[model samples]
Target: MAGCGFDDLPLTRPGPPLNAWGLYGEGDEYGRLNLITAQTVQAGLREAKEGITINLNLPLDTMPLNPTRAPLRHEIIHRTHCNDDHVSFNTQGSTQWDGFRHYPYLNYPEKQQYIYYGGMTSDEARDRSNHRCGIQNYAKKPISGRAHLLDIASFLERHQRSPLSYFDASTPIDLETLESCAAESRVVFKPGDILIVRTGWTEAFFGISEEERQSLPHRQKRGSCGVSSDPEVLRWHWENGIAAVASDAVAYEAYPSVNSPSIHETFLAGWGMPIGELFDLRELAAECKRLKRWTFFFTSMPLYVNGGIASPPNAQAVL
Candidate 1:
């Protein structure tokens, strides 16, 4: 079946709410990613006219942002006058792409029953024997396509003459604000385009003192400012044919979501769309402003671990 409108969701029989289970195909791991066809890639390549490349990943050592995750560890091994390095860290310690298995819908809240994309269960995702709906699926065909940036922070400062006072949980970038930003920037949506939003979360995180950084995880209210989890946001993403969405915020959507079935569950599990978080978009945003262009060629390759739930996005943008 062709990609249906957002109103025609819940394509599969007895499926969860706002799902696109059978839109791509049964047992299909790649959800919106399938939209990045060869033609789409070729079109993206055309955006590399200036021969400039910008790295979109934050340093691996800039991790342990979440207290639950282990800190990055690096060790050096010396042998025969040669040196080798061994590294170990959480795939999601820094910038990362949340895979299909990363988030699952709570189908039966009473019994705590969870369901992943394409009707895969949590147990199925945990079983390493089968690599269904894993990050490796993305590795098989790396995500590469034209990307559009909605510079929300910059837009507000330039046009509205009022910038965000704080980058925290209290702040929410609503759909209307995002539309206004895009309109002010003259960005036109296109099928198979990777949508990137800059919310200034990363900049705020790094701007504080080292003492404050150390106290982040221990804080009782550790919420991030990001896109709103309103159903209308999902409708906009589906209607625009966005293959994936990335942002500098810790969570692509406001952390501790105000709505049920957060963007993580709906996008990652329902639509099979990847969600990138903690991306370093400061440099990219500066370049976009310098060039006065919001579109670029975006590419990302995740780790090839079978049954992997998430991985750092080795991403780049060419213009």
Candidate 2:
């Protein structure tokens, strides 16, 4: 069939790829749901063989204070915990999806695309009972695929430099900067792979003096980086066909939008791809850099809470 009268057919064709990214596919345009099992997911973790679990557990202790811009008071009910026993569980914080509901696109400042598949509405998407892109999808089974870690820290280190020791509130991640980092790291990216960035910014804030750290421009806004976000950089990530993105930086992207626009529009709203903000990728990045290898058995399991807006994943980078 390949050589036979294929030339007779029109040059143009309309169809999805053998492995397309969106909700549907070619043969089964309305893709079938893949039920991930606990055993299968465990197998993925075992394949990683690192025996290391990067705790993506949300700092419940700090969460309550985050809303008030102060430390959490012990008197307040700890929503994420159940009991005082260290091992004894009392009550657990109701994990959320941090759905498109969690953030707004700074640039367009509009709602994420309301995609309805199989007669579902955008409002319904948030309904946990409906299971529309619930966090469960992230953990019902292991996410098995190619993963690439872009070591922003190593990239700068190779050039005898580094990102600021602290969030500068002025640092911005642009396309050129990302490309330059990739070139230095000698990393070649592939489509549909998870893209991870290592900024090393979160580390600086962890133990810094509250006054100096809080005074930083980005922190003054939201305890984020000093650099602003850029649209072109996001366009690059989307154009490259990245399935998802994770960053070591606290805010994933920059803090304040220099151009008054953020890439969240392009990646989250426009593409419907998820973002793993506040990922702890230091060791992972360091390991890849030292090994001079990138491909790995990557997996992350997000909490399976219904109607959840965000999830604290058990994200892992295994080689």
Compare the candidates by lDDT and give the number of the best one.
1
Off by over 4 Å in 1: 107-112, 161-168
Number of backbone collisions per candidate:
0, 19
**Cα lDDT over the full model 1:** 0.87
The model with the greatest TM-score is: 1
lDDT of 1 by residue, 2-60 (tens): 74888888787577778899887777899989999998999899988898999999999
Looking at model 1, which ten-residue stretch has the lowest summed lDDT?
A: 161-170
How many clashes show up in model 1? 0
lDDT, each prediction: 0.87, 0.49
Clashing pairs in 1: none
Q: On a 0 to 1 TM-score scale, where does candidate 1 land against the true structure?
A: 0.96
User: In lDDT terms, how accurate is model 2?
Assistant: 0.49
TM-score of each: 0.96, 0.64
